[model samples]
Target: MFKIKSLVFIFLVFYSTINYAQFTDVINSNRPGQSMAAFSVGKTVIQAELGINRIIEKDKDVDYKAAIWNSDLALRYGVFFEQFELIANLEYQNEKFTAPGVDIHEGALKKVLIGAKYLIYDPEKNYEKKPNLYSWKANHKFNWRQFIPAVGIYGGVNANLAKNKFLRGSDIPRDEDFTLKGMILTQNQFGRYTFLTNIILDKFPSQRNSIDYVLTMTRGFNDRVSGFLEIQGFNNEFYKDHFLRTGAAYLVRQNIQVDASVASNFQASPNIVFAGVGASWRFDANYNEVMLRVPKEEKNDGKSKKEKKDKEKKDKEKKKRKDAVENTEFK
Candidate 1:
């Protein structure tokens, strides 16, 4: 059952990708080619994602099937002057097979992550000083700045709850698994360009471990647009395999982003190409307070006058009462 489901999911993903490509081309007619945008930050953001992939091959002597489907939803909140952040995610995955009626599945509250970043310097500030030379130079050199490098860690667990009463009740055994991930990122600017690096480690319930390294160069085209090219390599210890990915991102707007990449494998599955589009919106607004000064005499005049009049009236009444007491004693 699992085997059949996996094959179906993979086919769906492949079919969807093809259809999306055609639709995007028609919508992006004005653009030169398929271009991807950059990722951005938001104060409070929510995201939902769905993805699928499939591969199938058949022959007189051999037959194969594979499919995958993934769905995820996440929420993130920013804090500490918008420099630190926390996020939580829930994910579900389904993979089925057909040739042999086998099913394998898992789902979980995927992860909770916390991270921080600090901006050390901005080249745009210097551009104001040397506007002519900076504008003319194709490759501008920006001052170097570093964000205190930090790591984000996450851990979660999942369980299998599927019922296979059709088969012998004893055939289905309850299983649980754990997952962990850690990531570290840092960036520095030279002149108008920035260098970024990331290291990630992940452990899965299947006793598989993976580590990835990424390096990228980013150029700020203007106040609103930035472009980057990145190279990433991943090592899977459980499968004794490695893969590499190269990609780039362009910032189209403050809230819109797109990414495209190609991946190749070493000592594992064949190479495949993939692309992605992502967008983020931050509803942060700025405010300013203005103060006006008033004359001190006008401010204190009304309330003070009323208080003085009340005090004099109270004193007069007390004096009259004292005089009346003296008259009564004399009588």
Candidate 2:
């Protein structure tokens, strides 16, 4: 009887954890892409994504060409709740610029950002889509709920480090040492495809302020291989350009991934091109599972009324025997 009770308790814990937890069995990382995912890393999980890129640009208006080597790192940590995460991003660049009778070499920290993201809505929580057993057409039919994407919001601040090379020669003034950044993130999944969108606002209150957006579509070819295409646009008072990017990622392990990508813009005035390779690693040894309560209506495991009565009777008998044994020992 004790063993039976223990088994039932174990089953409940397992079932509840699987049904309610946001933590995945494998590491979820945002790498090889600029857009952020709507889901956070599971609670207590820490992850790092690192990348390096080579960029070349030519401006017909200014008659200047530049080559840049860039390195970036992003660190993410899930804390407080499963739906929340903290993030830090750092990027640095080394550049060589050449023009008619001019040449120079320079390096600087491009940007540093610290932020937090919280998931506002998750469509799968407390809702399960069950297949229709009677009609194959019904089961395969499109559902309106697929349009509801998981939503997350991000808020952060950018540290304007000194000697930033990109800040110079900009039309917009940047007098402040720190700037604000915010984004609305959304993601949707259908079978082997995933779509992600990021609406971003950066450099708040400064003349360099800009609104940017990233739209990404990814398809999984297999369990360990995936590819993605992205469109990123920058809309600012002084600068407006759109870039097309494509990338692929390969999972090295449950907690590691590597990726490569290339991007180019359409503008000839400052034709821009870049290519990058990156890797992500996760450390989740500190993670602990948090279970949620299942709805009472869904708790019924298809047991009939008679079966429930029989189980109750057996439970009562076991309790009585346990009480009797305790009483005899006391006497």
User: Which runs in model 2 stand beyond 4 Å of their true positions?
Assistant: 1-20, 131-133, 168-170, 292-300, 303-331
**Each model's TM-score?**
0.45, 0.83
lDDT of 1 by residue, 1-331 (tens): 1111110000010111111111111111101111111111223332222223232312222232334343333333434332234444443444433334644443333222222333222222222122344465633445232332222222333322232221122433322344455555544444456555656565444434567565665554554444455555556632333334343334354433333333343432322333333333333343111111122333465346778789889999999999999999999
Candidate 1 has its poorest 10 consecutive residues by lDDT at 6-15
Model 2: per-residue Cα lDDT at residue 273:
84
Measured by lDDT, the strongest candidate is 2
Cα deviation of 17, candidate 1, in Å: 37
The candidate 2 region of ten consecutive residues with least summed lDDT is 1-10
Per model, how many backbone clashes are there?
31, 0
Give per-residue CA lDDT, model 2, range 1-331, as digits (tens).
0000000000000111245555766666677878888878878999888888888888878888888888888888999999999999888878788889978888877678899999898876767566667999999888788678989999999887844455436454654688999999988776667788999898786877889988888877876888888888888877788888888888889888888888888678788888888888889999887754243334676455788899999999999999999999999
